[model samples]
Target: MPSKSPTPGLKRRRSGIYWCATHQAVQAGFRPSVARLPYSLENPDHRPLIEANCQRLQAEMLQFLANGGREQPRRYDGTIQSLSGLYQIDAASPFRRLKHNSRLKDTYVLKLIEAAFGKRALSALRIADFYRWYDEIKKPKRPGGPERVRRAWGVIKKLRELFAYGVMAELPECERLYTILRHARFAQPARRRMVMRLAHVEAFIPQALAMGRLSLALGTALQFETALRQKDVIGEWEPIPAGAKRGADDFVLNGRRWVRGLTWADLPADLVIRKATTKTGAFAAHDLKLCPLVLDLLERIPSEKRTGPLIIDEVAGRPYAESAYGREWRIVARAAGIPNQVWNMDARAGAITEAEDAGADLDHIRSAAAHSQAATTQRYSRGAVGKSRRVAEMRLAYRGLRNGP
Candidate 1:
């Protein structure tokens, strides 16, 4: 006789435990307790175990019928895991509105939350539970490694976001838990003060070019000189939507399309670039003629070669993935004697700092950096003392004028 088909919502695992496929959770009290028990349902020796599992399944099925055959699709049992599932997958979720990169990161953090406290009911959670998880997650993943305080902080931040979503979704107990944790404080990692200088960029360029990485060199120079982010300089690969029309500019690879970076088209005229930034949608226009070093680097690329993306990974003929760009940039940076602390991303900060030192107007610097706020530009203008010196000079001049110098 042909083997019997499993029920619609349940399947037998290799360990002989029947899992509720629809619920994505094991059926309650259905797991085997004995070690190394024989799991063959066809064998007479395994009949007792099989019958017991079936009895549990039958009871649950009758209960489902008794309740008018309706159950929440994911069977929300008032657990954080169920709430997280709804938050992540529900069409009405705010999570769906997050940026592509943010969604990817939050998804990873959500997994950590699920693994740590998935089964815990929202009502049972206390603020102390969050602190305890914080202390544990901040510990190094590997023995003797540096403490993962940053990673732990990131998890806490995502958890807070999850709770906020739960409140919006109006899930049971979520609003209460969210209210209790409203004043909670978690540990934060120290602010990053590392910055890359023009000298580092200059050295990085020659070394990158020597290593046959023209794209890396161009990208580094663009970020430093134009105060553009790495994403705006090199673009990002996003998944191509199904049945979407592929345009001439679309770079399709493995079902993903690269979009929204500097292109030759953005530089409509020689020695000039005009483009809206990706993150803030701020318009950023720069005359390459004003950026001598950037001009020099641009000159090295022949006119014909500048037809497409200004930064293309020579090896793959595609724009560099963020991580790949960082890895390769490090090798060239290390060879150029740039300290490890000075990350590739610090190029924008370095540009802002340099502008501040050069006594550029705060608003002008903010515009060039495409920052929506002057405070954001000030934050990036780290280690520049010119502003203080300028303040002192103005005060002295005012006193002299009053005293008739």
Candidate 2:
């Protein structure tokens, strides 16, 4: 079903350790250990180094195999040798180039593993050691907070996967650290909502505008009105040229006005967002579709002398970060007398509710939201209708009567 990797070999020279085809073949599992010389006797110091390098190499090789290394040539032998030296496991091997995508994530995991178990051979690490490291990291601190601890746990989990592969490949002992931790997991309490009235939405928009936070105000209002994600607004916005031909920059509002719209249209339609992007690379136009109200809001935004971003910081005219925008939202909400129930995601929920109340079909709402799954659309539609107290009461009554109450 698949082609096999060529064998790996190593060469021992006075200058440094070099790979030979014979050793390569043995390392790749194609040849027996008898094919390579017994380093245990001739180079006593080299034996420990070689063994340690072998463990690390085995881990990297397994990962390479799992990833279906068809995209890149198999170069695990050189990479393992280099990483071993870099981490101070062995310094005799030449440095190797790391695959660009794997380099960042791998480096982060390796560093964390090393810090937790300093100078310990990769083979010597136990499940308990990993647990100890995780426990130490989870300790509450004044500056770092729970978020930092979560990041550490995530890195540890990824590293564990890498190491576990080596263990499975017979290079090292398998440690069930993550499984042990899972059994001790505690359930986090759900957050309670403090509901506020919808009229607060109207008040917030004006205040944000008064304070020169038009983008924040309009963005938040638009989200509530259209059920668009925050990234849909801030990340994606094309400026409507003062006077230009219709293109990606133009949008139709109220069946009359031609305006620009904020949308993720620039991104590849199939692009999956694994992380946040900065203002310079923030919005992709391809992932967004603008509603009429969103188009109207964009038309109202002053395009004259607008340079940095369509959505800018109220105080500084710089592009707004999600966190900064979130903070501004709180301030605007408080100013609008909605000190409670002003959540970031509530806009999306509210829009769904509004559409459902207007008797829009599930398919229509799903298309508007750009949801891929019909189940997700069903969930939103069900939640939107069931959220009303009157509807809930009616449903309960209907169910009771149907059950012969």
Candidate 3:
């Protein structure tokens, strides 16, 4: 038999939402699930917060059973830590809407904020305090390394969101912090200059195929030719929802599912991929028929092997985990005599660069890459001299035409 909960009227779910069972009965004896408390059960400090919420729910249930009205608003203490906890747990907060990897990075910064000034009064914080904090966190250059500000910038960005959440919730301190920090300036990291060219892809594919890693070669061609993000090409691992039925295409690892990648089903007889991107939820359509590289690689795979994920680890016979995918790609890249500085991620950038260099329309590049803005696509079009050379030629020709030379 399974053990009973020591805490009544509350159950902790595998996904970490604190499920509250305390609720008043409605018509037909149906009781709705009231809340999913965001407090961490593992954090010893959150125990009191958990108990308080549970007690509040039970009290509300009793009051509803007696008189049948709405539950009262829960009051939050105005501390940085308290606000941080609320921001994390609030369903309507932007924090909840972030992609999984982004959520993890943002949470790390939030934890740092909580540890540093968690107990401090939010209203007491000023511009000077943030300036000092930023300076303290930023790393100065050592003998061999450049100065680091990216981490500091990330912290400030997350902190701003935290303050914004508080303001949205109508907290006074957050309003003050938001108002004061409007004028503060922070340094941003330099843009990346490195990009993998089609030459690199051409070299990598043959080397990867020579080493019997057909999946790596195929994914490389897809990213370079189609401008698909690495995640969109290989998919991601996510915890399986409880009681979820497994599908034929589903790749299971322990209790998790490998989802949202280029399944064989995505490619029909038309050879055009039409699917919503995982990050932006925007539709990106790429015609594989236009990509001779992808076509040639596809022909190399045996017919039976083309049934599941387009990029599969042959040894595991499953989709590659993000880290494993990088590791294997690095091994093949090294064997191909690719530089250590060149990354598999650069394939998308390389594609954008190639398009820009070829004088393709900016809007067309943005559409193909599934970018919402041309500015975003512009960022990926890195270090191309072809566009500049074309511009120079056009200017000289115009001068010649004007001067009758």
Candidate 1, 37: how far from true, in Å?
A: 35
In model 3, pairs of residues that clash are none
Q: Model 2 compared with the native: what TM-score?
A: 0.46
Worst 10 residues of 1 by lDDT: 29-38
lDDT of 1 by residue, 1-405 (tens): 211433223344432334232222223322121112124556654454444334434444445444555432345679977788778656678887877667756765776677678889987888889889889999987799988999899987877777888888777888877776678887799877988898999899999989998888888988998999999988986655535799886677534578888887787667678888989898998988788777777778887787777788888787775467888899999999999999999999999999999999999999999899999999898899878989999999999999993
Runs in model 3 with CA error above 4 Å?
A: 1-75, 140-144
Candidate 1: residue 123 lDDT (0-100):
79
- Once superposed on the true structure, which residue ranges of model 2 sit more than 4 Å away at CA? 1-121, 142-156, 160-200, 236-299, 302-309, 313-318, 321-324, 327-331, 337-346, 349-366, 374-405
TM-score per prediction, in order, is 0.79, 0.46, 0.78
lDDT for every model? 0.75, 0.48, 0.78
lDDT of 2 by residue, 232-321 (tens): 556522222334466553333211222223423332334322222232232222222444444555557564634433565666444553
Per-residue CA lDDT of model 3 for 1-405, tens digit only, reads 111433446775544544354333443132233344556788886665566556544554555455555433334687887787777657678887776567656665776677667788886777988888887777765556656688777778778888888889888789778777666798877878889998899999999999999999999999999999998999987655545799976777644589888989899999999988988989999999999999999998788877878899888888996478899999999999999989999999999999989888889999999999999999998987667888999999999999994
Where's the lowest-lDDT run of ten residues in candidate 3?
23-32
